[model samples]
Every structure is written in C-alpha cells, then in structure tokens.
Target chain A: MIRMRDLRKDFSVRVPAGRLRREKRLVSAVDGVSLTIEPGEMVGYIGPNGAGKSTTLKMLTGVLSPTSGEVSVFGLTPVPQRTRLALRIGVVFGQRSQLWWDLPLRESFRLLRHVYQVPPAEHEQRLRRCREMLDLDAFLDTPVRQLSLGQRMRGEITAALLHGPKVLFLDEPTIGLDVVSKQAVRSFLAELGATGAVTVVLTTHDLADIERLCDRLVVIDHGRVVHDGTIEALHARYGSRRSLVVDLDSPLPAGFVLPGTSVAGVEADGHRVTFALDETSAAAAVAGLVAVASVRDLSVVEPDIEDVVARLYRAG
Target chain B: MAETGETWAGETWAGGTRAGAIRAYAALVGGKWRSMLSYRASFAAELLSNVGATVLDVTTVFVLFRATATVGGFTLAEAILMTGLTAFGFVLADLTVGNIDDLKRYVRTGQLDTMLTRPLPVLPQLVFTDLPLRKLLRLVFGAAVYGVALAVNDVPWTAGRVLLAAVAPLGAGLFFGAIFVLTASFAFWWVESGEIGNGFTYGGRDFTSYPITVYAHWFRDLFAYALGFGFVSYQPALALLGRADPLGLPAWAGFVAPLVALPAVAVATLAWRTGIRHYRSTGS
Candidate 1:
C-alpha cells in the first residue's frame, strides 16, 4: 500500500549568533530511510523527539515533499499524486485539531462527507457505525472545543476514517489523555486493526501505546530506521526496565532493599534513589514506597528507546 | 468501482467531481463563517471598523473636492465615484485572500499539513476556507455610493459606460486577488509573508484610491504598467467620464481589464503551484 525508497528531507534553520549575526544550517530531518507497509498491517513508528518519526509520516501523507527520495502511496508518487493519494489515506495529527474548532462534531462529519464525497446514505451508515464503536453519540451536538480531549480525539479519528481510506496514518493518537481515555484509544485502535480493513501507521513517543496497539514496531532515530521488528524482539534485544525516581526525606540506610525493585542508581545525597522494576512489579514498588516514612517527590519514568539506542551506540 | 463503505481497494479518485469540490468549498466557507459567528462581538466590531474606514475615505475625498473645483481634473462627484470603485476593488481582492492572515498561522502551527492530507486540493481549501464574509458589506455599501455619485455627477447614461464602470473593477479586484495569491505563495518560500503582502494588497489599494493624475508621471506609470493598480479605478473612471488618458495609455485602455487582470491571475496561480511543489513545511 505504501513504499519509500531512500527518503530524505532536509530543512534549513536559522540560528542567531553574537549580537547581530545569524547562521543558516541545513538539518536532515529524514535521511536515507526506506520503508514498505502492507495492507491490514498496524505498524508503530517510534523514536525520540526530532528522530524523523513525524517527518516520515508527513512524507507518506504527501504533506511534505522529500528533498531526495522516491515515495509512492498506492504506486503513485506522493508529491505529484498527493491529492489523489489523499483520497486513499486518512491521517490524524494528535497535537492539532483537524475538526473545525467551534462547530459541532456532527457538523464536521457532514463537512467531511462533502470533502470526501461520500454518498449521503453511506455517510450515515459510517457515522452510525463510528458512533456506536466510539460511543460518540452522547456528545454529537457538542462543539469540538467543548468536548474533553478524549472525545475530541475520537471525533478526529471518526472524521479521518469517514472517507474509508485504505491506510490510516496517526501521529500520537494518545498523547495528553487520562488513563481511561488512553485505554479507550488503545482498545479502539486495537479493534480497528483486528478488523483487517485498513492498514495503520502510528508515530508516538509513548511506549505503552506501541506495546498495546502495534503488531510490528519500526524505530527510527537521527533520521534513520534503527530497528524494525516485533515488540517482543525490541524487548528481547533492548528489553528495558522502568525507572522509579524517589526522593527520600532523609538519607537511606546502607543496605536497604526496595520491596519489588533493585537499586538502579543513587545521587550524591543518599536521599535520591532510582529503582528499576519490571512492568508487573510497578504497583508493588509504589506500595513499597508508600510504606516508607517520608518521600519528597516520586515519578515513574517509562522505558525510553532513545536511551536504548544510545546504549547500543556506546557499546558499538 | 469498489464496494460502498469499504476501504478503497485500490487507486481511484476521491470525489474528484467539480460539484463535490464546490460543495467542499462551501462547507469550508460555512465552517469558517460559523467560527466567526462564534465570536459575534469580534465580527460586529470588525464590520463597524470597515464601515468607519469607508466613511473616512469618502470624507477625505469630499473634503478635498470642497476645497477646490477639481483635484486632478476630477469633479466632486467623480472623486466620490473613484472612492466607491477603489473600495470595491479592495472588496474583490479580499474575497480570495481575506483570511490570508491565517495563512502564516497555518504554516507556523503546522495546520497546513492537516489541510494537505485532505482529498480536496489544498489551494482552494486554503483560499476559500476562512474568507472574511463580513467584508461583503463593503461592496454593497460601495455600490450604493456609486449610484449616488453617478446621479450627483449627472453623467450621461449609456449602457457601455455603466457596464464599463461595473465590470472594470471586478477584473481589477481579480487582479488584486492575484497579488494576494502571489504573496501567499511567496510565504511558502520566505515564511514571513504578511508584511510584504500588505504592501501590495493594502498599499496598492491605497495608491489607486485617488486619481492617477494626482501623482507625478513616474509614480503614475509605476503603479499602472508596473503594479497593475491603475486598472482598478483610474482607467475605468477615465473611460466612464470620457476623458483622455493623460498617462499616454491607449484611449481604449479602460477596456483592457481582461488583458491585464487575467494574465496576472494566471502568473499568480503559476507561482502558487511552484511554491507548493517545493513546499518545505515548517519543523517536522
């Protein structure tokens, strides 16, 4: 359904220097990356910030013309064939609202009907199906801004798919959502992928999003694809442990052992501690921390693929 | 064709019909109008400001005519007609590029990517989506003033003369719209387009408001042959009043509306397409 050969996108950025001088620099956002996505496959494109994940998606959707590359969506060059390719694909940008901000959700759907030229009957059917699947009818009349983030995201997803696109490209579909909203989006995507109707390409920084929704994982960094495999393979090779940073009110004893985790690191003052825990042990570790007398600040940091890539670079 | 309600099985056009495209544009406009409607106070304020600006422009011309028998050989009534025509020219230009102020925002905030992903062509969606619908009032107001000006001036009524007066500015407005398109296209390359575009869209409108004879010969030629603002009001008014062209243009130059404006629009369209072809969207 999609193919990219040696895709490269270079951006010129200006940097201010000294009092009154600026430097022009060309930064390669996507460099010599190649990819092929088949129909009915859900692939998660993961990378650290500025790691070319969004750039690749933009090229696939024909939003950006690559500096030096060959890109074909449904066998047509994406840049020249962007408009035609657009008909076959739908994209959801997580950070931005694609629906009209002030209009009701149903109004946006109606606009999409004209935009994609869906027959009215087909549009109604699609809307009914989407509303049922996403539980959208509850707030159908609400303006997009009035809805919660999760509702708005669901609205965007429905709008993107109303045209029945062959491929769905999502950039961060679950950012800034409450736990329940995140779970809803994850389940929705999983169900959508299970139906085997449309191929899905998702780019997100969140690891749990990848773990739940993706059948295949493609990791990119510094403008190149670093890993292309299954989640198990990523876990096996760079199987990461989660870190829980806890600041104690006072120094810890020399031989203290955390209940469910092993000590990962400690700051100069023994009050700062990092505990490494597996996914299942997270709740127990937090419970262990609750038992401790005094804690200043506590945060659970997810597994970061950038660090995994960096560790590999250092070892190589 | 593929079965309905199924994901496209293969490559095919998505709603490529002109009717569908027009429907999409109307929806886009309707969406923008509703968005503006949400801010009713802002819309009302903007409408009042535009009407105030028009009134002030009329007062400037009226005060000048009051002080002298004729400024640049234009009678009081002729000057008022020029005011009406110039204002209409602006209204026409704004129809296409009224919301161009949003173009810069779209670029900076990456909304352009959202637009490009749609099945519809990007240019029409961008051009028509956020048009300032409130500005249409200025045109109606201008037309009313034009009728009063023609009546007060007591110019002999002829079909050719009245037709020229109406059609000429429409063409000129298209020409100004062409400039708006050009400036938006330039934004794709330069990334800062508002100031530069204003020089043409706003500056050109201001320059053409008065009689071309009010300016020195060099300035008049620059704005006429060089920038194409002359066709907006000066040439058409001259032809309507049956006065000779003082700038050495052909006596039939007032009818050259299509000759000048159409090509300008064509060039602007070409520039816009090129800009899109090489478009490097802001940060990834």
Candidate 2:
C-alpha cells in the first residue's frame, strides 16, 4: 500500500542573532530511509525523540516533500499529486484535531461528507457504522471542544474514517489518553485492521500500543531504520537474556560461582542474589541457582519491547 | 467498486478544482460561522466593539475636517465621503481577510500540517476557516455613516454614482484582501515576519484614510507606485467625486478598478504557490 525509497527530508532554518546578523543552517531530519508497507497490515514506527518518525509519516501523507527519492501511496506519487492522495488517505494527529472546535461532532462529519463527495446513501451507512463501532452516538450532539479527551479522539477517528480511506496514518493517536481510553482506541484499531480494508501506520512512543495493535515493527533511530521485523522476530533476536532473582534461606558461601552465569547484584541481607545468564537455557540457569542457594523465592525477568529497542540503539 | 475507483481516480487526476474547491470552502465557512454563532455574548461584544471603533475613527476625521475646512482640494463633504467609503472598504476587507492575518499562528502552532493534508487549496481553506462576521456590523455602520454624510452634505447621488460607489468598495476590498494573501505567503519562509505583512495591509489603510495629497511628494509617489494604495481608495474616489486626477494617470484608469484587483489577486496566488513549495522542501 505504501512504498518509500531513498527518502530524505532536510530543513533549512535561519538562525536569528541579536539585531541584524543571521545565518542559514541545514538539518537533515530523515536520511536515506526506505520502507514498504503492505495492505491491511498494522505497522508500528517507533523511534526516540527527533528520530524522523514524524517526518517519515509526513512525507507519506504528503504534508512534507522529500529532498531526494520517491514515495508512492497506493501506486500514486504523494508529492506530484497530493490532493488526490488526500482523498484516499485519512490522518489523525494526536496532538491536534481536525474537527471544528465549537461545532457538534455530527456537523463536522456532515461537512466532511460533503467535502469528500460521498454519496448520500454511502455517507449515511458509513456514519452509522462508524458511530456504532466507536460508540459515538452519546456525544455526537456535543461540541467537539466540550468532549473529553477520549471522546474527542473517538470523534477524530470517526471523522478520519467516515470516507473509508484505504490507509490511516495515526501519529501518536493515543498520546494523552488515559489507560481505559487507550485500550478502547487500541481495540477499535485492532478491529479495523482485522477487516483487511485499511492499512495503518501508527507512530508512537507507547510501546504497549505497539505490542497490542501492531504485528510488524519498524524501529528508527537518528534518521535511520535500525531494525525492521515482526514483533516475535525482534523478541527472539534481542530478548534472549534472562535475569534470575534468587533469595536464599541461609547466608553466604563465599566466592561461589555458577556456570554460564554472572552475579549482577546482591542484596545487603546477603541471602538475595541476581544473575545475568547468557542466551543458552533458562532451565539450566534456574537449576544451577537451585543447587547453590536455598531458593526461598525465584523470579525470571524477560526482555520487553522498550528494552530491546533501547539496547538496539545503544549497540548502534 | 472498480467503476467507483475509476471515477474517483479520474476526478483525482483532474484535480477536482471546481466542485471540490467550492464545497471545501463552503464547509469551512459554514462550520466557522456556526461556531461564531454559538458564543452569542462574545459575538455581540465583538460587533459592538467594532461599531465603537468605526464611530470613533469617523468622528476624528469629521473633527479634523471642521478645523481644516478642506483637505488637499477636497471639500468637507468630499473628505467625509472619502473617509466613509474608505472605512467601509476597510471593514469589508477585514471581514474577508481577518483569518489570513492569523496564518502565522497556524504556522507557529503547527496547525498548517492539518491544512496541508486536506484535498483543497490552503489559502482558501484558511480564509474560509474564520469569516469574522463581527466585521459585517462595522461595514453596515460605515455605510450608514456614509449615507448620512452624503444626505446631510447635499451631495447629489444619482443611480450611476450610487452603483459605482457600491462596486468601488467591493473592488477596493478585493485589492486589500489580495495584499493580505500575498503577505501571508511570507509566513512559510519567515515565520516571525507575519506581522510585517500587517504593516502593508492595516498600515496602508491608516495612511490612505486621509487625503494622499496631504503627504509630501515622495511619500505620495511611493504610496501610489510602490504600494498602489491609490488604486484601492484615492484614484477611485477621484473619479467618483468628479475631481481632476491628482496623480494624472488617465481618465480610463478609474474604470479598471476590477482589472487592477484581478492582478493583485493573481500575484498573491502565485506567491502562495511558491511559498507552498518552500514549505514542502524545508518543512519549516
């Protein structure tokens, strides 16, 4: 559904001095990034601050043009003919809304329907479906400005999807939502992807959002993609290290070492110990710890998505 | 479904300029108008403030005329007419282009990204987003004042003169509006310089409210040639008042007010397109 090759975006900004002197500087926001997204796939584009995730999304949505290379959305170049591409794509910026602030949610949807030239029958059908799917009927009459953050986000999702776009670009769609609201948004997005009619490119720092809604992941750092693979693949690749916390009933055997494990830290009580084991066997590490300590309590800490991405960047 | 896709693709390639632009602009204006109507008290207060400001300005001009007896070869009645008409033209421009002045805020707050993704021209979308209906009250107040001044001063108002007067204000409004658009186009490159555009728009109005000939030779020529404030108010009023041309362009120049407005709008639009290119490349 989307193809980007050798995509680069640079910004030339003027540096203001005290009175009259000024200088121009160029900062490359996105550099030589190439990506492809398949139809109906939910992909999470994750990166640290200023890692060019938003810039890449903007390029795909035709909000920003690439300094070099090509971007095609559903077989059409986004920059050469952006207005047409807009008709087929829906975008939701988490920090901002596209709805008319003082007007009711229904009015904004009606205006969009007319603007998109949706046939009346199709418009009504889509409106009903979106409202039912998003549970928006209760607040449809309320002004958008009056709606709660969650309600406003639901309204935004409905507004973006009312035209039945083939692809939805959600830039931090769940940024400020509460836990319950985030779950509600995630479930709706999941169902939308299940239908196989819309492709979603979700860019967010919320790793939980990535874990729940995205199957494939693209991790970008410093304007480059450092890792791209399925969530399972990433987990298997970097998530091999395990930490075992062992609490012994009795104190100290001095200088006792376990095979294939290094003691990470020990508690002051001298009965608790932590070990970092290589990616060999969890069973063997637990067995080795059981032989040396009483093992009053045992816990295994597995690697998470956030930790994996952090380690990947650190290694880079 | 294939046929629908084909139709959509065809419309997309054609750019959908006619119905798409019209529908988008109407929706924007309609939504904004509805929002404005929602806050009745604030709306009323805004309208009242506009009326008060208009009255104060007209009164100042009237008092000045009483002291001077005439300004730049124009009688007291003619000066009142000029002030009234210019006031009306300015109010109309404010009503239409008030939102264009707020484009800097859009750029600064990053709201321009939302506008860029829409399937419409950003300028029209920006203009339609906020209509500022409060200024309409000011327009009416200025028109009423102009009417009373013309009646009390015993200036003859024939049907042709009345028609010309009505159309002249619209042409002038368009001319000023074009200037606002051109100025707003600069926000794409120099974000902080949005206020600089205001210097030409509101500043030109404030300067031309008085007789242009009252100024020095260089200032008058600068305003005439460089800024073209004469096309907006001075020369049009010269023809309307049946006075000899001060700048001495030609007898036919006043009749081409609409033509003059067309080019200003065209140039402004060209600047806007160029600005969009800059925005796309720089992302600033």
Candidate 3:
C-alpha cells in the first residue's frame, strides 16, 4: 500500500540577480498533494510537463526527501527506511537505461539477481517467465547499447520484475516506442496487472497506454491533483460527449429527424453521419438511427480522454 | 504463469544480510570487469596508459634529483621514499575509491537516482559498478617503486621501522580515500563542481611528493599540517628514514599516519551522509 498525506517538495534554484550576484529562490515542485493507492491497483499518473509527477514519484521511491508532509510505502518511511523499502519496490525510468550499457542483456539480469540477492530457484523462475512473456530470448546475448529502444525497454521491464517487487513505478514506459512495440508493452503490462500481484503507478503522455491498461486515472497539474477517478468519470466531469457514426446505403432526407441525438458532423457526403449521443446509450441511438435510415455500418466512439485531460490541466 | 499466493507467503522482505551485501558488491564489480574487457583494445590501452602515467610521476622525481643533491634537506633516496609512499597511497585510493569523481556526472544524468533505488549502499554500488580494474597494474608499479626506495634507503630494518613501512602505505591509501570521498561529496550541493575535488586529491598527492621543507612555511602549514597531507607521506617517510623534522615537529608524528587517517575518514563519512540528504534529484 502507498499512502501520502499533504506531501510537498521544494527546490532552491540559483538565478542571476545582477551583474555580480546570484539569488536563491524556492520553487514548489509538489504542493499539498495527497493520495492513497491500494495494492494490486494499476493507476495512470498523468500531467503536463513539470507537473510534479516525477517529483512525487521520486519522493515515493525514496530518491528525494520530501520538504514536508508524510509518505508511507508498505508501512515504511521512504527516506529513513529506504533500503528496507527498496526490497519491495521496483522503478523503471524510460528516459534512462539502468542496464549496463556494454554488457549483454542476460548479464545485466544475472547481476541484478545478485544485487537483489534472490534465491537461484526464484531468480530462474522469474527470468523464464519474463523471457517468455516479454519475448527477450532473441536479444538476450546482445549488449544493451546495441539493442533497439523497444528491445531495451522490454529488457528494462524484465529487470524490474525479476525480484517480484510488490510495487512497480514506471515513468513514461512507452514514451518513444513504435506502434507494434507499444502494443507489445501494453499487453505485457495488462497481463501483469491481471495477476494482481504488483501495484503499478505509471506516468506517461500516451493516453492510449492509459486507456488500454489503467482502470483508474490520477491527473495532476501544477503540483496539485485536479482529477482522480475512472476515465468515464473524467468524461462525465468534463461533459465530453460520446459520438456514434453510421454509413448509410442512401443519404437521409433533408428533414430527417433522429430523436435523443444531435448531428455532430456530416462526412462522405450525406451517406455518412455522426450523431452525438445525449444521456441515452449508443444502443438507443443506433436503434433510432436504424429506424430512420438504411444503415450499412456504424461505430460508437467514446469521449476523448486527451481532450478531457487537457481541459483538466487548463482548469488546474 | 499463474498468480500464486504461495509465492508471496514464501517471500522474504527482510533487509539483505552482510553476506548478501558482499555477494552484491562482488557481482557488481565482476560485471564491471567483464564490461571493461568487452572493449579489448580500449581496456589494453587504458591499462598501458595508466602505468605510463605512474612512470611519468616517478621519472619527474628522478629528473628533479639530477639537478640537485638534495631537495629541502632530504637526500634523493629519502625524497624517493616520500615519493614512493605518496604514490602507493594515492594509487591504492585511486584504484579503489577514485571513480567517485564521477558523482557529478551521475547527479547530472540522473544515474544516482537509479542507484538509490537499489537495495544496497549507494557508495559501494557506485564504487564497485565502475571499479577501475585497469589500475591494478599501476598499483603494482607503485608498490615496486616503494620496494626499490626501501632497498636504496638503508638503516630501515628496525622493528618499528619495519611495521611503519608495512602500514604507512595502507595509511596513505586510507587518507587519500577520505580525501576523494570528501571532495566528491561537494557534487551534491554544487552539481557543476567537478574539478574542484581534483585539487585536493591529486593536489595533495603532488604536495606530499617531496619533503615538506621544500615548500614555503605558510603553504606547507596549510596543506601539509592543517589538512594533514603531511602525515600521508612526508612525516611517515621521516619515521621510516629515521630522520628529524626540519620544521620542529615531534618524531612520533611520523608514526601517527594511521591515527591521522581515522579522523579524516570520520569527517569524510559525515560529509557524505550530510551531502546525501541534500541531494535534489534532477528534473526528468
């Protein structure tokens, strides 16, 4: 379990004052943020640039001491009890490579086994699982520096899980991955989450990653939590409408009326129409559309989480 | 794989034991050694160049001696003994604890945060991860010079002299190790302060390369006496050579090299702990 109460972190930065002098100014990176994350919950921590997301993660992982307030990860104070807490937590920073740059991927894993002091049996079991799940066999012998970004990201996630940490913190795990690689990573994390063993808190700009993997989303802006709920709740909070589009075999009449829906847009001449569903379900809108027009194909598009989050940031 | 509750029941969340820590260090150091060897040509070049650098230091002493009978009231043999002792200590520290100078880069690059996440002491992890195995040959060369210096300086066969000769190098290594750590700790407060530490570590090595009498009174007093670089080699060499201090220090001061190292080590440890607390992780 992770619990933080009114956590705050401030950094003192030096700025030029005049021709021959400099001044120190205190900047609040994280201010009055409070949260509680239960075990086995995969939460997406999202924010704009410099939103104190990384700072909060650092404080949670014991890398940075909080300037004020409280933090408890697995019932231990992160800073004073860092070594003790480290045994149960794993961190992956996508922008950085934790593996030895010159050694083969397998060598880094083997070294980490000793670094974490895992029993050989458990280590081998976890390695086998990661190797199979993450498809790491092909590049196991290749030096980390030679691996592609996608391959290296897989290796990094594998390395973090070898010790079976109770909590996993990933910062932008899919930041630079290509489409195929991103899907591979998302599916792997989805399966990992299905096991309900590790509590995952990940921060990323990729809403697709969040939409596919996270059941809960926590959005912060300018060092404060502006929204914390499910994605559908976020859509409702922002009044973002869900739209249903239909491809009709024939164009609807100029005075055609579909009840409980409004025309969001018309595309592909009059053969296609997008209906913004009101408080009614997509089924009701589809039935109303079928009754009114000869529908060939139709699909419902949920409210864009990205736009809702953008509005959340603007409000914050 | 199935999610097994038994795995969690069997999990050991206890902190690693001392034996486990040792295994961790060995594993980290061994990984570094293999990584270094992967670039065969660079490894070979670094080893040779490291030895060459030590040879240059010894050659400079010899070249200076050719111009004068004695430097600051010490014969060439005695000066060489001081040089050998300084080299032995500095090289030992350099080979083991010297890479700490990269703390600035680690902080700037956010590598230190990665290290802090590991369930081990950060210092040992940093030292072992980049252990300078290539410097092993240079340490051997420094020891050889110390051996030759002892042979050239006769009258160093007494029981106390034998013990001093045996332990002084180790003392100097500890002293220099302290200096390296103390200076590297400055990075936590000032990330751009890289070369500032070299002034104390390498600067102290150069200062104690000759007899303290060769330096001006205030200069010698500052680095040699006040900072205790004198005890690293100069005073210890005096004890081994059975010589008196020209500056009127007690004879037993030479025997207290190890004693001097203890306080320096303590101060360095304190500085390192305080610095770690002040570490403000770099923004992502």
Best by TM-score: 3
Which 10 residues in a row give candidate 2 chain B its minimum summed lDDT? B3-12
Name every residue pair that clashes in candidate 3: none
Candidate 2 lDDT by residue in tens digits, B160-194: 56766778778777878888888988887777884
Candidate 1 local lDDT, B1-284, one digit each (tens): 12322533323454479878898898888888888898999898888887787677667787777789888877777777777777776677786676665677787787888889988777788877777777767777767776676677655568888788668768767878888888877777777665887887777877777887888888878887687778778877777777777667776887664457888889998988897776776554
- RMSD to the hidden true structure, all candidates: 6.6, 3.9, 2.6
10 residues in a row with least lDDT, candidate 3 chain A: A191-200
For candidate 3, what is the lDDT?
0.89
Please, what is the TM-score per model? Answer: 0.85, 0.89, 0.94
The parts of candidate 2 lying over 4 Å away from their true place are: A14-22, A236-239, A250-270, A275-279, A284-293, B1-17, B145-167, B280-284
CAPRI docking class of candidate 3: medium
How well is each residue in A267-290 modelled by candidate 2, as lDDT tens digits?
958788878876446679888767
Which of candidates 1 and 3 reaches a greater lDDT? 3
TM-score of 1: 0.85
Residue A307 lDDT, candidate 3, scale 0-100: 81
- Computed on C-alpha atoms, the DockQ of candidate 3 is 0.57
Q: What would the TM-score be for candidate 3 when compared with the true structure?
A: 0.94
Fraction of true contacts kept, per model?
0.57, 0.35, 0.56
Q: Encode model 3's per-residue lDDT on A1-316: one tens digit a residue.
A: 8999999999988899998899999998998899999998999999999999999999999999999999999999998998888889989999878899999999999999999998888888778877888899999999999999999999999888888798889999999899988988999888888778778899999999899999999998888998888998888878889899999998999987777888988988888899888777899888877887789999999788888888888888
Candidate 1 residue pairs in backbone clash? none
